[model samples]
Target: MQISFEEFVTARGPALLRFAYLLCGDRYLAEDVLQEVLARAYRRWSRIGGAPEPYLRKAVLNQYLSWWRRKSSSEALVATVPDRVQAYRTADELAARDEIWTLLATLPRPQRAVLVLRYYLDLSDSEIAELLGYAVPTVRVYAFRALGRLRAALSGRAPTTEARSG
Candidate 1:
């Protein structure tokens, strides 16, 4: 059975927002992009062919990428120190996460997306390929290259090779 918009949003909205935040690395922009995609999905609710979640996700990804492309030329780097949090996480965990987040931001958009999809979303190569409109091999390549970059970043080395576009 097809899911209603309200039901779908109620169940998946938080997860979608988290995904968006991971994608954009900005909570406010993530919310805005998710809202924009949700509005568009609502407008086309009747025509959307299968389960709406996938469509909504694709919409979110497309919207984020569109915004990134538009703003990339003018993007500037600003160093902001994260505030200390009184939470369950140890200082090491927080630092590692922060470091990874910073490294992720330095990656190219596609590589960052690939890493997010594979690690954060726990999707397989085939699934990511389908979601990102890439061939399976291309998806693997992206993942491989992204992981290499991340490893290099963590190890304080520059990426050894440039990522090949598939």
Candidate 2:
């Protein structure tokens, strides 16, 4: 069966935006990428076949990766500590999450993407590899390297040379 583009977006847009945000770690960039992907998808909406979600998601990933490639060197890093606000989570939990996000922002795009895809999205390595157009081994390698970096950072140690290489 087929669905209108508007109906699909109404149902899936928020989740797609969240996925893009996790992939890129920037809200504005994520929105831009999603908008661009949706616009292109709309142009050929009629032609899209069964389960457009996967195709649209992959498009967002590809767009973010390509944009990262083009702008990686020129991107600026800014560190700011957000004001503490009382919420459901404890202060320590919030601080830890902030620290982890900081570390995640430091990772290379592909490594960050792998980590987000594996953990946040809870996709298996094979599924991640297929989505990323990478071999399963490569996906594993990225996850390993990313996790190693996060572990080392959390433990206040430098990553090993092997982890630093790729």
Evaluate model 2: give its TM-score: 0.89
lDDT of every model, 2 decimals = 0.82, 0.87
Which runs of model 1 end up more than 4 angstroms from their true locations?
Answer: 71-84, 162-166
lDDT of 1 by residue, 3-53 (tens): 788888999999999999999887777898899999988888879966777
TM of each candidate vs. truth: 0.85, 0.89
Among all windows of 10 consecutive residues in model 2, the one with the lowest summed lDDT is 71-80
Task: State, as a TM-score between 0 and 1, how close model 1 is to the true structure.
Answer: 0.85
lDDT at 134 for candidate 1? 86
Candidate 1's error at 122, in angstroms? 2.1
Q: What is the lDDT of candidate 1?
A: 0.82
lDDT of 2 by residue, 75-135 (tens): 5646545565667899799889888878988898899988888888898999999999899
